[model samples]
Target: MVASRSQVADVAANAFRRSCLMARISTKEELRRIIAEPRPATRVKILDSLDEQSIEFLKRCPFALVGTTSADGTVEVSPKGDEPGFIRVEDPKTLLIPERVGNNLAFGLNNILDTGEIGIIALVPATGETLRISGTAEIHDDPELVASLSSLGKPALLATRVRIKHCYFHCARSIVRAKLWDPKAWPAPGRISFGKIIAPRIGESEAVAAQIDANVEGAYTTRLWQNT
Candidate 1:
């Protein structure tokens, strides 16, 4: 007997992406069964655009993670950070994010160029709450605008203007569980070095590690303030 069309589609949808992670929660029923439903208050938090509270929250956030996707399905989450209020909220429905200097992977920016879909979560220091913003992104190359949002005498090459569709404050549960701001909870010092990380790739010896570390610090001191 042939399976019905719905059953066939269900079978196709349930296919696992990786064999090792095959114990997948493929169906909505499977997902929901393990997680409790959200309260009505949680549902009501989503907003069509930024409101006064959200605007203030954004003003306090000096760091944010932006998620974007390429047309080919590659996903990236890039961090954009500077002074607080670096991300300009031009109006209730508009947001301007300064694109600063970096490693030049440009994953998030390139994805924005490709598909325009963007999701952002703005965070303040030692704060558990985060502001989530989702919308389409449009790149702006006006030098004056870039300069206006500049930091430490350096200007962005461009800004990504987000036309807000949904904005909300994400709850603090995850942050709380992680004890993000607790100095006591932080891992002990002697953290891994970037020099050690790149040494293997660069085929460098212990003597070169110090040179690499110096180069990294010099780059941060010099190029960090250069025009993006």
Candidate 2:
């Protein structure tokens, strides 16, 4: 006899669960054993400071992601962007990020305050290579430093200083695989209702989404670019 839809669904779900369980590589030792170490060229790419090559790469990059973790081990990532050369290579070992106005949640900033550890992944458009920087961070609110990195007549409220511990030029394999800069490979953009996702966490889930959506539209049209 043919299986009913409910029976078929049950069988499919069980198979998926089994596949997921079997596919997980359970431990770091297991992962290390399966993957070979980096080749000499790859190994040599890691450096202690911003070399001339790395400095040039960063000067050309307009965007980067900041990764940080709180003392409690909560992790957060925030995106930073501006015109090319927005990030200043203050010295061979230090880099500065101008803290512009954002959502004001300050998740990334608070993490830096709590733990002082930070990571950076800087990317340039149309270039498959990326720069990765791992460092200890401190927040600087000095007027001179903030004014030095101003954008559009508004100085940054603060600046984030990263004293590099290790930095590297990451190869292009990941970017090439993702086809990140190829417009032809991109999916059509869609509107996202972020409010719908958060509504259930706060109060009555029904009206919250609409209220948040309206607030978002208002901000986007009026207040979004006011600070920057």
Query: In terms of TM-score, how similar is model 1 to the real structure?
Result: 0.83
lDDT of candidate 2 vs native? 0.90
Q: Which residues of candidate 1, in runs, are more than 4 Å off?
A: 1-22, 189-192
RMSD after CA superposition, every candidate = 7.9, 4.0
Tens-digit lDDT string for candidate 2 (1-228): 999999999999999999999989998877888897768987887899999999999889899999999999999999999879888999989999998877889999999999999999999999998999999999999999999998878888899999999999888899889999999989999778868877977864668898888877777777655542
Task: For residues 1-228, write the lDDT of model 1, one tens digit per residue.
Answer: 999999988776766435536767888988889997889988899999999999998888899999999999988999888999988999999999998877778888889989999999999999899999999998999989999888878788789999999999988999999999899999877634688888878899877887778876766787566533
In candidate 2, position 182 carries an lDDT of 92
Candidate 1, after superposition: displacement of residue 177 in Å?
A: 1.3
Model 1 residue 191 lDDT score: 39
Q: Per-residue error at 33 for model 1, in Å? A: 1.5
lDDT of each: 0.87, 0.90
The alpha-carbon deviation from the true structure for residue 192 of candidate 1, after best TM-score superposition, in angstroms, is 4.1
